[model samples]
Target: MVLETSSTAEASIRAPADEAAAERDLARRAQRGDPSAYAQLVRGNQGRILRHLLNLTGSRDEALELSQEVFLKAWEALPSWRPEARFHTWLYRIASNVAYDLLRRRQLVSFEPLPPDHDTPAETDSPEVRLHAKQTIGQLDAALARLPPEQREIVLLREVEGLSYEELAAALAIDEGTVKSRLARGRAALAQIYTRMQT
Candidate 1:
């Protein structure tokens, strides 16, 4: 279920309208209680959603649990879904809410620094390269962890999840202008953090 980010970006750029149409059709069928349609939706999206949650929470176990909750919530709410929003956007909204709720409940929780299995280096990588990669990821994780929840969410959705500005606005219940502003601020903050870490 490890989705290639390049594929996601290519797909998003290639035929968003066609993809939306297909998702809408599946959603309609799922709303009508088509188990196969729902399963297909889950299979297609689970990896992306889990990756986003992992980036947000920095914990694979929490991400996995929250992802299951997200799909379940999506299923229960499927009947009321309107096709005005893309299916992935709607699911992202749900996932964001779930992550935010968890963050609120466990305020200031300490996340482990890049769990072993979360993003392992390739076996072919030299030890020095692997160490460098791990250190970079750790710095990035620390920077993300320090961001305000809203800013962090925006950054992850835009940068890590490769969500379009429109999708981010819909998923976060913000306007596109707001998405741009927040993304700018988030990136700036992250840059500052990285610079400080480097020093």
Candidate 2:
């Protein structure tokens, strides 16, 4: 089921302790085969998961499809759920694996970036300014596409998804040191690419 955008934002603003308690409760219920609890989990996480996948794959359609797969996998794996990791981090790990598998099957290196959605206020900007903004976004997207998949994944997880070092290590199944090293390299590479594009 599609979650409303407003609800997602509301979920994000919730107190962390309260949210974690709720998530743990829901996870417990879901592990016990409660469909409603599973549905709640999906509603809570769908937006961020979709956004993360979109940035990773650079295609809304692919992201949407892969997100469905992610939820399904999560459902199937619920019985094995342990609270050792945060539910969202587990979901991200699933999403990363799903995106990587699809990219491999399709033999795609990267996707061309689409224009930004209508979130930017049209009333505030002149056409020339809007055009420039789009161009810059496009340039950055191309630079992101040029990164190796491992580097790209690290950059997207750290920068776009805002995963912490520990969270990123959990999601990517790497040690924290590896996450730090890859992120540093990824940021350096992205900066170089962006610079070259500007020149």
Candidate 3:
């Protein structure tokens, strides 16, 4: 006699806990040697991790390889993970270490614009508009490249990754005040560079 709505059905199928709680539960399961739970966690985080690495390394190939390494390291260290810390933040700390090590070893200075992930009107617009968009992206990449690695990393994590100051601190093993100052300086430097490029 009762017809269930789609939303109600979805609600029933989904967990009652919030997303953070759900992630914690998954982390606990993963720590218990549940491959499926670990796989789910990887799937949830892989895209953001890949995009972040791509921006940091400036190469799609390097990003792909580094993403695999990050997951491998994460899985290996999962047993030591503390439940008090956020799972994603812990993973991010690992990722930051991996990336910074590679950057330092290579003394990498080259950079490329991130590949467009969205289909925007610019893509369908006139050739001139598309060209302008491409130039802007390139300019942005050049500006980012000019920043010191620390500032660039903080800027990307804060702006591109949308991580909070506290999250950035945790990920980079720095204090929240440091994160804020670095982000502010990075923004100011980036603005100066971008403005010069515009002129």
Candidate 4:
């Protein structure tokens, strides 16, 4: 039994130890000329990346195209990848930078459609829920657009990605205090907008 247990343990180790191990394995395999690992990585992140692009760029079509481009870029850069950071965090940083670069080049990003999220409510409650949700989201989008790009990025990093202050700092290449200060200021501005919405 002891020998059997040891063999199983060794087999599991040969498989993957954990997420970090898997990340390293996938990265190495991709680096050593495995296309499937890169495909798997792209599949794992496609949805999240597209949604984030949707929010950041405000265009579903562009988001889709950019997500593809992000994967292509990732494939090209995979050999350079060092697992010094969370893979998703690194991917997101790249996507964010890509979106920013595209925006900078075009001088604007097209706005996303603002149809309400009326799908998450009970049939009876959906009307009211959607009404309020639309108003709130509309106000948020307006205020978000009005904010400077850096401020909007911070706000979305906090609220949408749910990155911690330390994580946001690392992702944005800013300080933790700056993350906190930006969050506070951004929320305050959002509050003012919501209050005006109430009035």
Q: How far is 15's C-alpha from truth in model 3 (Å)?
A: 12
| lDDT tens digits, residue span 1-199, model 2 | 2468878777777777587788999999999989999999999999999988887787898999999999999999987778888899999999999998988998987666654771243557998987887777777788988988889888988887788999899999999999999999999999999999888
lDDT of 3 by residue, 40-123 (tens): 999999998987888788778888899999999999999889887778888888877888888888987655555554223355
Better of 1 and 4 by TM-score: 1
**RMSD vs true structure, all candidates:** 5.5, 6.8, 4.9, 6.6
Models 1 onward score TM values of 0.87, 0.86, 0.84, 0.76
Error of 4 at 66 (Å): 1.1
TM-score of candidate 2 relative to the true fold: 0.86
Distance from true location, Cα of 115 in model 3, Å: 5.9
- The superposed Cα distance between candidate 4 and the true structure at residue 85, in angstroms, equals 0.8
In model 1, the clashing pairs are none
Model 1 lDDT tens row, 7-99: 887788878678778889999999999999999999989999998888778788899999999999999999778989889999999998898
Ranking by TM-score: 1, 2, 3, 4
Report the lDDT of model 4 for residue 131. Answer: 75
Poorest 10 consecutive residues by lDDT, candidate 1: 108-117
Kindly report which residue stretches of model 1 are placed more than 4 angstroms away from their true locations once superposed.
1-14, 109-112
lDDT of each: 0.86, 0.87, 0.83, 0.74
Best model per TM-score:
1
- What is the clash tally of candidate 2? 0
